[model samples]
Target: MEISFTPEIRRAGLAGAGARLLGVAAVLVSLLLLLAAGPPAAADTTQVRALLHQGQDLLRAGQNDAARPLLLQARTLAQKVHFEAGEIEALRVLGKAELVHGSFAEARAFLTQGVALARRTPGQPGLADVLLALGQVANEQDDYPGALRACEEALRLYHDQGKLRDEARTRNGLGIIYSSRGDFPRALAMLLPALHQTQQLRDSALQANCLTNLGGVYFRNNDARKALYYFGQALPLVRRQPDQGALADCLTNLAVAHQQLGEFRQAEPFYQQAIAVSERAGEQAQLGVVLSDYAQLLTDLKRLPAAQTTLERARALLEKSGDVGTLAATLVALGHLHQQLGHGAEAETQAHRALALATPIKDWSVQESAGGLLASLRKRRGDYKEALRYTELAQAAHDTLFTQSKAEEMGRLQGDYQLSQERERAQALARTGERQQQRLQAQQRQLWGLGLGLAAAALAGLALWRLNRLLGRKNQQIERQRAELTELNATKDRLFSIIGHDLRGPLHSLHAFVELLAGPPLPPDKLAHYTQRLTHTLDHTLALLENLLHWAALQMGAAGPPRPENLDLAALANENIGLLTAAAEAAQVSLAHSLTGEEQAWADPAAVRLVLRNLLANAIKFTPAGGTVQVSARRTGAVWQLAVADTGRGLPAPTPLQELRPETLPRRAGEGGQARSTGLGLQLSRDAAARNGGQLLVASAGPGQGTTFTLKVPVAETVEVPV
Candidate 1:
């Protein structure tokens, strides 16, 4: 039926009775069937089944909230009946209802149990259906890979059973997964097959779903023309379907496609239509999404007031539904709209809220969008520093998402290419066999002229030998170049490692001591203590610098490292900690040393000291005031382990670290609390440890926790001085 395109409809409230009546009728029919097959003379079971049927009807009508209690009642009844299958079904339906209600955790618990039960039922299509539901749950949670796997498994089982319609449904689910992951080609591949199946089956509802998915894939792939084409195809099918939900989705897809094409007039109507359908169906979540889409469209169209109002309604609906992800997105849209309307404070508030929500979800798209909006707001308010921070975040988020998508696409393309190559090779082999037989027949006749053939062959062989020799020389040249490049990279890494490890001691000492001196004067005893500490710090700093300079010169092909020397790592760690004690105490942090007994490491003493000093100093700096920095050394088999653990701020999240590489080591923090380094300390420690026939490991338990830097060095029996 024709739904009204109004603000109320956009908020996801039901429209006129026609759509509701049909949904109710469907629910009644389903209930009747369920009752007819249910236990005889069980009034409680009947009532529960009826309520469940009513919920399903309400759900079909898009009245998620109204359906929730009924579904809950069904679950309670199923539990009372102790019917395992019935309970599973009740849980499954309840989970689906909860999903629509945005009760993700509750939904997950129900669906997970349903999946387990379904899996237990051998040779049943119910398992595939459960898998499909699980996939949708995962999709809602934004666990794209999990969703993809679930959908793939469901599709496989359905196909194996020759359940074409179920397979089509599963394929549509996969399309959604691939589309969300930015794998447009794969999404299209999935959607097209499902679309074909649905068309063959003449399932209008399924057809609409497939078409909508296809349209989304096209939209994401930047093929607006194709997106519009698919969306238009979906619209007619959705119109014919009894389910207005499909119609709503189709309308939204079409709107998005049209919007992207700059067909504002066409887009507006579709968005309005989608909102009307969602409202009529009482799908608040869907309605919120539709409202956000329309608001975004309005904002793009420069209709600020309308956009703001639309965004507010969407936000409210999302908040009511507890859809934080969508709510955040709505906030971001609202922020942008407010910013456009010159409302600075309002914009900032919205932007901050958006960021708060977006950060936890780890949805890069939402994060980037929120970041951009926040950056813009900051810039408009003349807060350049804050603006720059947000801008960088946005850029980083964009880069990460782009890189991930590109890598996945490249991997898929590579796989496809390899498969195609194998197929072609197989075909070529078959053709070659046929040709070889023909050649053998010809060769039989040619055997009579063997002497003439041999003379020509001998000349050809001599020419081939000369060409082979030339190619061999070229290969040797290429190999030599590769070796040179390898050596250069090694030299570069060595230089960086030295620079990173060696500079930390002096630089840190200088920074800390400067802070000390700039502060109020201390008593005579404390002054003397400071002086002694500063002197010790200088000695270690100078030694590290000397070694670094020498290493750099050596790396530049200028002189040499005499040879590896046996060094006492425990002594080195102790010496460095002694130097750092004053600075650590000045920061109100305690240095806990636990190096017992001597462990000799086979390395340049200078290099070992640098590694130990850098690690200790880093721990001290990052540890908050009153936090303890613990340094310990122990022998593990042939290696000496030196670890510096801090009870302070830990390492940042793993995501930023994933981008780090050897060359990018000694990473320095930018303006954003990012780890700033040339990423050198760990790399330097690693190199120094390796030089002594060992390795260095750095581990952190996330932000604000703690960090441990361990240096594993090979034990040496005798002290050997570098000649």
Candidate 2:
């Protein structure tokens, strides 16, 4: 049960795991040494076999880009000669090369063709080899569950074929996949016999894969020291048989491990080596995943702009390869970079895009990174409830990754495997001479394997228990949210009640004023007063209805998709000022704006207009005759702060941003003899601000002091709108 752990290259280029910079590679697998076979034709099967062997050897030597031509040639020759097995072998090996190089779509194409050919051929289940290649491809693509099934079936077939070599390779594939999925117990269980089995074989490829994958488990478990130990052990072996781009990916694994250990000087060379190797091999995954990881090291070195360029290059490379798993990680890295650069909206877009491509290829690191960033962004914008949900998502990923107890258990599992391997070694030595020692040592190996097996079984139970507890907690959280929703519905009913009562007066006044105007032939002054009153009531009712409808639409989630744009704040404010000038004049309030003309925001222009109109109208209404309502704006990091300050009867107290919640009643900006407002305007403004990726903040000194309502919206750095 001697397990050489492969460096599970955790994708740290993703935002999750606090940038530990990668677990080892899931798809940096052993290229299968497939045996070629076919009926003799004009072109001898032997020549085809030789070509396949040479190409596969080059593949094993870490030259996939170099090997692909040869493999393609073999497939062509086999196809011409009607040798299905040879064609299938070539296709399978080609798929293997592509899969290891992080070209999943191409890999699947090749593997699917191999499967089709194998199914049509009349022979032993050639499907096993093809299935193994498909499984490896699937695993690298982040379709772990699918991969596990494919590999398990391949494992059964390999056993039936009595191919211990193939079986060990399949099992090792299973181990790496299990490790990728955060299933340490199952990973160890698979790796134990696979590593033990490989030790008896003369295959450096399988042995290197075993050790490298075992290292991956340690990396996932967060035991960087132990992870480094296994990675260090596996690298030379990986170098010996650098299948596809395993050597480059292995270099990345070493870099991250060293990076995690704070050995940047040591980490840098490995990262450069990985870049060089991946460049030489022209493998996108290594260049994409590993180079992005190397960018993080640059960030650590305080080379921010260079890191940005490096990350962009990695992202561009991945975008072309159709490796969504790697692409998602790259997006996560880009989001993190945006976060560092104070581009909140851009960062959010990147994270959401990463989250949006939800396929079976579930990279927890991508989920973790995306979730963590989203949570932070939500919190920054004062949406604690949404933040909490994202925080829970991040926490779930973090907890599943590894706990101290889980790590301790894995350590024990490793010790058990190590002990059995030593016992087997002892048994081998004893068998050379001492029969008594051999018998005792043989018993030790069995005992060690059995004991570790039992421990792994116990861990399975523990995992189930933990999962159930997590599920129960999740259920409780769901139930709690349901209750909150119920409360929100009730609160909405109350808000409707209030809106209805407020609308009642305006409507009744409008009806009575219209009737009086229609029926009465009164004195000139009286008729004029009635006409003015009727018009005033109509305007008030229309304004109330508009605000009420806007509120209702937002609450009902029927507002449709946002139509955000890069809006010039100064122009928009000027337009609003022109629209509100008559009202300002009627109220004898002087309206002024201090927009420097360069202020701009990224927001829905329509929504922003409503928000600004509401705030300004509220200010004008609250201000006494001869008072001033002034509009001003300033840039604040990644947002624009537009403030409407009014000389009026101020708020009773300072209103906190948290008080802007829907559940909280809006505090009137002022309360004086000047005018009475229903307070819906402020609420409408607040809601509109929130919808536009902004918030309306209220500040006031107690009664009669001026109030300032500042609307915060995302800054428009360019014409490009965020998704």
Best by lDDT: 2
Task: Please give the RMSD to the true structure for each candidate, in Å.
Answer: 13.9, 24.7
lDDT of 1 by residue, 44-84 (tens): 56666677667766776677766776677677766777645
Stretches of candidate 1 off by over 4 Å are 1-163, 356-563, 566-601, 604-610, 616-620, 623-723
Q: Which 10 residues in a row give candidate 1 its minimum summed lDDT? A: 1-10
Specify the poorest-scoring 10-residue window by lDDT in model 2: 21-30
Q: TM-scores of the models, in the given order?
A: 0.53, 0.36
Error of 2 at 440 (Å): 40
Tens digit of lDDT per residue, candidate 2, span 1-723?
111223342221234452221121211111221233345563356656767877666655565555677788788878887888889889888887776676789999998888888888998437898888787777666655557667877799889889998889778877876776677888989988998899899677777778888888888888888888878878888887746488887888889999998999999998998898888998876688887898889989888889989988988898888878878877888898889989999999999988776325656667877988998898778654476567656655554443434544544444445445556656755563365445445545655577776765566567557756865786687679768766765556546455545566555445544544554355788667656655655665677788888877887788886799888888999999999999788778999898877776889999989988988888887788899999998876897888889998776665543335433544342323222356677777887777767887877775688778888889875854334
